[model samples]
Target chain A: MSSSTTPALPMHEVRAEATWLQRNKMIVTPLLFLLPGMLFFAVYVIFPIFQSFGISLYRWDGLGEATYIGLANYEELLTDRNFEISLVNNLKWLVLYLLAIPLGLFIALFLNQTVMGIRLYKSLFFFPFVLSQVVVGLVFSWFYLPREGLLNTIITGLGFDSLNILGDPTLATYGIIAAGLWPQTAYCMILYLTGLNAVDPEQVEAGRLDGAKGWKMLWYVILPQLKPATFIAFVVTIIGALRSFDLISVMTNGGPFGSTRVLSFYMFERALSEFGFRMGYGSAIAVVLFLIMLVFIGYFLWQMWRDEREARRG
Target chain B: MFPTPIEKRSRAAQITYQSLLPLALILWLLPLIAVMVFSIRPFSDFTQGNYWGVPSSFELFTNYGMVFFESDMPRYLLNSVFITVPTVIGAVALSCMTGFALGIYRFRGNLLIFFMFIAGNFVPFQILMVPVRDLTVDMGLYDTKLGLILFHVAFQTGFCTLFMRNFIRALPYELIEAARVEGVAEWRIFWFVVLPLMRPAIAALSVLIFTFIWNDYFWAIVLTQGPDAQPVTAGITSFNSQFVAQYHLMSAGSIVAAIPPVAIFFLMQRHFIAGLTLGAVK
Candidate 1:
């Protein structure tokens, strides 16, 4: 009966001699194969998402008896100063983090040449992305150390007062973003490199013959062909920007004056930190963030669905 | 091809380009280079403010030795290995089966299920945090390596499934059709025909997942705590506080924590890149 749906398989002759399991293998097999993964994913990933939304409507310490306080957690978010700061910073992150795409393209273009040991150079440029964000955060924190850091060493040597980037509230977020871009740009560069590798040589030659050169060639001819790569680069960069938790956690811990608190770090601080166990409040923050991310996720899925449809047709 | 090859350029431009490449690389990696230098220096150099100068003495072994034996760094590292390895194995294993099921079957809700995995993979960790932590504690697995491992595996499966299913889809349909024509059992076909052909995807996903799980700081902290279960990413925080104001030790510890993924990446460079840029071409 299950084999009826599997158009790719023809089991008519074998069906008469087979057991129920073998006859229903197409459906049963996939269901059996999907069960463990789906169960685990549902238990760990899927259910928790809805549970978080449910939990957000109630005020409960994680361990204590819960009290339903419908929408209070979210109402508080409206007036919360830190929430405002975090929201603005998230916008800042969203906009600035995209710089990695063009920056990555620039680097990829720079190193796209076939020279001696260029492969090694490409790998070296991509080095920062391989390291954990914890490590990257640590390294950058040290790099921003006012007195002992390399940045200041160069600054002081150049007859200027050494600046404390991370300690300043206004500059701290940008400081972290710059550290983030180091790896993110590297990631984007690799994407573009791979994209550039697949670019049609004939079209490039045609454009060149028609008097396209330098930026004009890149903008008119190459960029259109690199659309898939740019799309991916856009998706990952957006995700990376929003998922900027580890670096902030390590660098400032929502520091100097609670200036660097994005929704992610702030949510953790409320829910789990020594300040208090405001699980409901944290969940509300997470929900807002989830909503923001949903926009991008929906866009990505629609694009993918379109591509999948195209692939099936073509 | 897009930029016109350097061989097509002038001689002076070529020499200048060659010189700029290394210089740009050095500048780009300067922060990491500084950390490497700091890891090799004695504490005296930092105290004396000799940061940019030549190290007064190289104490690489001593600092790293302290991190290994004197601190809980070794335990944290071992926990990271235990947590990461199992998660990699479990996630990859589950996804291979899931990927095969989703990729090959023409069932109702196939695209829906595939989209579920993809969308879940993109969700923020914070959304899953409060409940996942609660769930772990209720199961009496909190602050244990196994707790971290289970959560990592489940979370990572979303991604691994997306990767593996696409890889399986790209495999020749004729191969599976031919196997079906030979009257092979479905499971037998998966095991004998598809699984063997999936070796490259398996290898690529292994290294990719290893790097991701190893570098995962968010879940490590949320699901576990302390040296007993915390991976190196979290452990490095405690290690830093222990050696607070001890820049040399912190540098050595971070470098040690970062080495595994970096080594794996360098060794499996081709497979690593292949896994990363999977859909970029299309």
Candidate 2:
């Protein structure tokens, strides 16, 4: 019972031991664990942002010396017609891509029940999102092919003239957007399905007891709980819309008179592709795209921060 | 459950709903179904204008082999695996540490760093494209699989860190505190205690990152040019161009390019969906 009193160690020895532990563990341990990750992240991700910003003010073809030219590229962007087209197309993408959220919610609702062979149904529906965008683009391109394509065949079978979707500038952007929606809707559906799983059954039953059903029940009860899912859906859809390069690249190569060009594809064309290595102009385009994204980024961070604060409080 | 179940509906309504499901699915997936059919059909079917009929002959194996023998499809597949695997392991390993640091620790710049990751994760690839490419070239990694892996690992770390941090933060802090009070070293606590709990997160991220990197066409085109480093997504582009009129071969190649990720998804559908919808629901 009195073991503490039996052995009295020197206070200096105890202090020395505690200090050594602190030095070796608290300070050194975290450093060892953190250094490798932070270093690479800083070098490749964090450093590149500032470096790109710096290069945006210079005229350089990736290899040669970067000549200083402050704001000239940005100034040129103001009058560039293609930049204008890309910007407009980006706006169109942002608007049209939001459709996926509702479409996905509908699909999720349709498949939410426990039915026979439902697992197979869900997987089949989820199949599109699993495939690569390259495949999606190729498939859609074939679908939109002029004569023998699925779309034209369907149209011609109905005694209508074959509609040239990818060939027509006005319809080409919409055509690509539709193809993009195929997977995006699937992604949204998965999110909504997960959301639906966690929804309180009691609330639905209570709403039913109160004679609230269908859209009324959804708006009044279900949607409130689905806020988190909807917020994520919105954020991802927005990001997907802005970062739509692969589909545009594969399906049209920003072709049919550059009408379908978004900023990402346009930037790629300017900087990397065989079109021309106007690195400065490309960076300028990148800067604009970055600025556009910054708005949403700020909003997303604020929302996340607020949510974390609420989570902490709870 | 919010909407009325189809079973409870009138018989007419039930029949309409049940009958419409397959039709809707078919219409929704018409493009994909068309490609699937075309991938199996003989080349003569296209030339003969027998687009809607049964395939003249099933040529799936022949077409698939043609993609590999006639083109750089094998190299592309190898490049994809090379880039994707390393990037997944590297990003996940790094993020586990960073996430532990940010999530478990209460430091001055913790929130700042977390928000930085969140913001950085959302930035367009274009913003980083020029300098990233230049940096890769300067480091002598341009047009190499290593260059693609490096960028992907770095880029994906932003997202992975966010996910891992939130996941770790949700773990009971008392366990770490209890270990520390027992005089356990911080690194040991992380390795023995925290790392084990991260298996689910790691699995989810592995599948998700595998898909993202495998399907990445942009970086493949940007960082790597030739067959030596190009992944299947970009390689399929070249295949498409070479087989301009050969729809059967192109379709076959597209199917081949899609198989890996599709297999991963089907094998791990639950984890894949869970990973995708991680932040979507509370």
Candidate 3:
């Protein structure tokens, strides 16, 4: 009987061998699937960062021959008034942009109820975030457009003089920041809404039973649970503040004596725009921005690492 | 759940709250509403201080026509679509593979690579500006949609990869083990077994990317200059310059430029929120 089944045994062995190959195929297959993506990412994203760092060390117009400038651009940046102004404005933005978090929390708390047509109201509130910043800038510019603008029309209706929010050097930056806050606050509201959804109802009930009410309930029980949402809102708001170029460009073009020139927009004006294409100096400004962001990036990465490790351990 | 519900309050409080709701919303949206109203108002309304009043005449069509015919609005729209669509497709497709590899495979540098992506996603765009622009010019892709698309796809990969990897990681590991025991190839396991389950993630990512790339003004301005490659955001800047003081036309153009992403948000509001708040809840 064993000899009669020998041919069938060979066929069976061949099928088993094929099965073994298939089972172990992943050992070699993922590389094939990952190559194209990795290549594109390396070329377009990863490599360019290093390339930019290299370019920062040299002086070159985009078209002409390149010349190495070493720390000369950095030396100039140390004494550059415009760079200082831009840096100061960025600090202001960082400080003021944080207002979005509290404002967003207020709005989120206001709209958290299960009222009739609440969904439509929520969406309507979120409309600003959906639109482009350019549109937001335009809308705000019109609103801030002297006496005939919406803001002034309302101010005058109350018998106050029309305020030129964008024209005044002192107020221009704040005006632009206010426009930025509109969408950013909406963004934060959405995050808080999500966070509110996951709040421990039992904790809330217990707090209420303990005679906690109003601000006490919020301060003692609710706000602590919304830490994750607050953290993200703070992070994105800071980044948004630092990267605030569009509103500056659209609203006032960093006008009224360049009072609103954040580092990001200042870098763009120096490097690319018609501001003499000072590539090396522009790179220097970028390096400063990069250094500022590096601090936060490191913190965020550390936090994320800790979270992941804790998740895995649990 | 955090605050006392409006209904549980006294009658006067509820009435006051309801009244304040619309008022707060109106104040919050005053700028946007002003633009919407101005888009339809005649030029005289702006000139004659009738901004907040009813439009003197319905000039919506005429103003919208001016944006397209009098300016390079059509070209700008095309440029935006060209750059955004390709970037979304390329970034999503690449991340799907990268995500699968990093999520499932136990590798030495997996965490390191994932962290690289997360860090890269947060870095300031200005830091990458000089070298990226130079590279684009070197490759003769500057002032072209291709240049913009390549950069966007690359930059967006950091984000897309982070999202995709986290999404893929949350799936049950046993599915892959079972597929392996059944003698399925790894690539086949990814394509036939895991890929189908990524539909919700893909949908979420696609809409998010579409809105992000479509509304990107920074790269649009940095990479391209002329109408030939200028996206709507940058194009509007130029139009603002050309049509300075023509508030009616500018408002119309703003509305036109805003339509696409707003439409996307309404269509995929759930996915958009989910994608945005991926890490917020937990």
Give the winner by TM-score. 1
Over the stretch A1-314, how does candidate 2's per-residue lDDT look in tens digits? 12322222223345544555454344355556667777787887788778888888999887778899999999999999999999999999999999999999999998886656778888889889988888899899999999779889889889999989998999999999999999999999988988988999999999999999888999999999899999999999999999999999889989899999999999999998797798888988998899999999999999988998899799
Best by DockQ: 1
User: Which of 1 and 2 is ahead in TM-score?
Assistant: 1
- Arrange candidates, best lDDT first: 1, 2, 3
Judged by lDDT, which candidate is best? Answer: 1
Better of 1 and 3 by lDDT: 1
Fnat, one value per model: 0.79, 0.69, 0.64
What interface RMSD, in Å and to 1 decimal, does model 3 have? 6.5
Chain A TM-score per candidate?
0.96, 0.93, 0.90
Categorize the docking of model 2. medium
Writing each residue's lDDT as its tens digit, candidate 1 over A25-54 gives 677888899999999999999999999999
Candidate 2's DockQ is 0.56
